[model samples]
Target: MGDASVVEKIYDLVVIGAGWYGLGSAKAYIQLHPNEKILVLEAENSCGGTWSKDRLYPGLKSNNLWGSYEFPDFPMEEKVYGVSEGQHIPAATLHRYLTDFAKNFGIFERTLFQTKVDSVEATANDEWALNVTSNTSTIQRIQTKKLIVATGLTSQPNMPSYPGEESFVPPFFHAKEFCNRADTVQTCKKATVVGAGKSAFDVAYAFATEGDAQVDLIIRPTGQGPVWICPPYVTPLKRKMEELLSTRALTFMSPCPWQGEDGFSMAHSFLHRTGVGRFIVNNFWNQISSEVVETHGYNDDPEVFKLKPWNSAMWTGSGVGIHNYQTNFFDLVKEGKIRVHLADIVKLDQNTIHLNNGEAFETEVLICATGWKKTSEGLKFKNFSSGLSYTTSDIKRLSKEADKKVHEMFPILKDQPVLRGPVKAEEPLRNYRFIVPSGAVFKRNIAYAGMVSTVCTSIFSTVQGLWISAFLDGKLQRAPKTEDEVTKEIMLHTQFEKWRYPCGYGASLPDFAFDSIPYVDLLVNDLGLKNHRKSSPILELLEAYKPKDYLGLGEEWVEAYGNQ
Candidate 1:
């Protein structure tokens, strides 16, 4: 606002996106460092990243419980499923909550709203050069000592291709556009939704409830892992049953679950997903029964999944899992409120959508909820985020593996050359917590400012865990405790697999995932009630975790020296 032509002062740290993760880093940083030069750049005038955006149809809400989505902090320590009868926070409400988080913490003061980061470049020095445009404003460059790429995956919708729909032109847009209400083209008598993912369901449900129109839903064979709106209370009980059934099934070599003859064990699933596979048992039950879309996968898998495009995993199997229809989404399809078309498109025309079976359906208005494609159309600006040039080799080096597809990983500088006078040796050890390589150590530097150089960042751990690690190094005192350093130490530990970050495999189940309990004997740990939380509800009968005492819930470092 001052001196339009003047370049803003360089910041100690430059944070992109003001969403949940973004706010986590900023607020945590401020907790320990009061006067750091930090600047938050948001494309929209507001702070909620995904929640603040995406209107799709109305009566919109989240499937995740309100308690599950609460920020990890004091004050709002109490949680509930306020809307979904004690289930999840709605999309609109989430947006407002995040907005409130920023206002209360005064984070907006550090923000340059209506600004979009178009590109970034690595300066001759290690600092980052960002080219950002404020709403309707000229492009401006801001230099900062550090850059936080907190823009989440949802920021980009994975749109798929459809036929002859481009010319329809009534009012076609992504789910993001529908959130605003005005984005609807013609809510014509027959509205056809092209995808069956969660967004597609939301789109279909919205049109039916808000537009009062019968909706036709088109689902790709693999896109249907539909979990419906079950009472959240039942989740725990149902989960236990499945686990016991899976354990017994796997032990006695009983028939595989999910009706698979492939004998696809959960072990194999974990192997493919970096040992961090989603709960397949849950996946089957949820998708076949639930309506929320869990994964927004690209048709081009290995290409998008691998770090170097070469380190891809094999596909197991996928198809529609909509067998439970007494009252499932398919029931809506059966009731004619929502029509179902099972054929894949063989052709596309201005007025007709042809499926592979050569069947053509004429429609009044088409809601190409056909989904968005993953393209480099407008988001190529990430190429400009730093000074050093990025290559496949660069990504591999940073990933500490042949692959560079980091989902829940914190980006860091791994395998960078360590000089030893004239000759460079494989970095002997990672020096600091933020700087640790997988299962290794190195020259230590706590000033997180220059310390985002770990081999692999944990993307799956508590978001607070990732947030605090980087925040401490970047803005806070830049100090790590013994345990913090040790755990991060193991991450950088030189022992290959031991040095590697934990994969999202079979471990996320109740017991395995929550194994690292923090002293709360009877408390809920993100996953809710501990013991029964492990296996499944069927196996565990009725249950409760009313922990009389919380154990190991607080680490020595986290309790005594965290973002207090």
Candidate 2:
């Protein structure tokens, strides 16, 4: 049954990737335009996207609190360790929440499971044509007036190529493959994890505590030396703030100028642009962080504390959030349950891995907690295994051809910088709001979701979906209007990312680098929602911001805007 048959269909809009972003995007768009023909194609068998079953590893927990991880409208009711009171929830709980969100919003019916998009190209009518293959190897051609790429980041594994590691006898794999391979992990006597990000730490902890394997955490030296590690910030005042803000609709509104778009409230523009607000906030952050660090024994070792890349305030602002360890990780290191090694792997022997610092360790399995490769590699389509003729489509090649045609059609957009080929992992994506091409191509047929990294995944994805939908519906008022403006904004934002975060993950894209809440407010305001503050100007200036209720914000907009 190798391409024995082909099916063709046309849709008003087609969304790729059935994860949280895709589902949320589809729901938001469809809610506004109920009559539109929509289709959602997912490579996996179910919804949840990144939170799907395959990515759920043992003892995996969110970096942020569950309250922030949940959608504004659909809150988690479970009393799990990390769910109810500003704690980290298990990966499984988050998956269940995502599944429920899709069902609650009626996004399941519009979705097609186990279908992979092979290619998407612009048609002559300014529409898009997609070549997709199903899990069963059935091929189809789909034409849609609009396309939404919701695959976001984390779709591909960013595997590191180590020298001489190919000769190792034990199994070596990325963290993404470790979920169902627990048995394999248990059999290993010694395991080594590369990198020091959240996933790297998670794998190391599991191997040491669960599998009882002697685990070595390999960390590379950055500008600040060792990576920063700290406990979650769940002070009573902060928890009270979250609770208070969550029920108020105004907290979701951003008063600041968003990505240089116009129409920002004068007060907000002054505070955010003049550096006055940040200075005040910074002082407050330092005080709270010092108190927390002292109270929790976090500063018992002055040398280790000084080596942190960021202070607690800066770390939270950098989107690093806080790591919620069930037990004190440092104590484990002290107990010798987990060993920390600071060196790069130079080479590997049959039974040992040699470090550049001249230390060598016998490794049975090497676990790479390294993040995924760039979005381009993950989004790049492959031909079906069945070797069907029409099933083959190259997304990058098609995008270039479409870009040329589109530019020829709109000559003014021709001068705009077009990403002619695959984007390298090291470079930041040139997307406005991290969801649409910031160039002057004037193309609304394609949009992106979930490309941004923020402290609040659920709320961020929700606002992104709403903003993208509003953009496609022409409800936005201050989008960058010229080629030069787009280019200027992109360069400025890129530099800001580097200046703010300086290195590792945060250095690439500063979507929500320091203040994710403010970023959300900006997106919300751009969606025609009024960013309201307290009646008293003094209170507005002094209030500490937190994630708040956005459910009413959208509803109020629907009532006021009438869905156009």
Top TM-score hit: 2
Worst 10 residues of 2 by lDDT: 383-392
lDDT of 2 at 422: 36
Evaluated at residue 522, the lDDT of candidate 2 is: 68
Residues forming the 10-long window of minimal summed lDDT in candidate 1: 307-316
* lDDT tens digits by residue: candidate 1, 341-373: 654666557766677756677665555554332
Give candidate 2 misplaced runs (Cα > 4 Å). 1-8, 79-83, 222-227, 234-307, 310-321, 380-426, 439-441, 504-507, 533-548
Model 2 TM-score? Answer: 0.79
Cα-based TM-score, every candidate: 0.58, 0.79
**Which tens-of-lDDT digit does each residue in 1-564 have in candidate 2?**
112233337888888987778877887887777888887888877778778878788888777665566776776776533357666778888788777777777677767777878777666677877887786445577888887888867778888787887787777888888886777567886889887666777888788877888888887653223444545644555433232223222222222124223233454344443457545545655665565566445467543343244434333333343557777666666667677776778888898988888999898888887777646453543221111112124423433444444333223222222222233345456566667765313667678888766556667777788778778767775576776565554544443443334333444555453345556656876766765434555544345333355665557668877546
TM-score of 1: 0.58
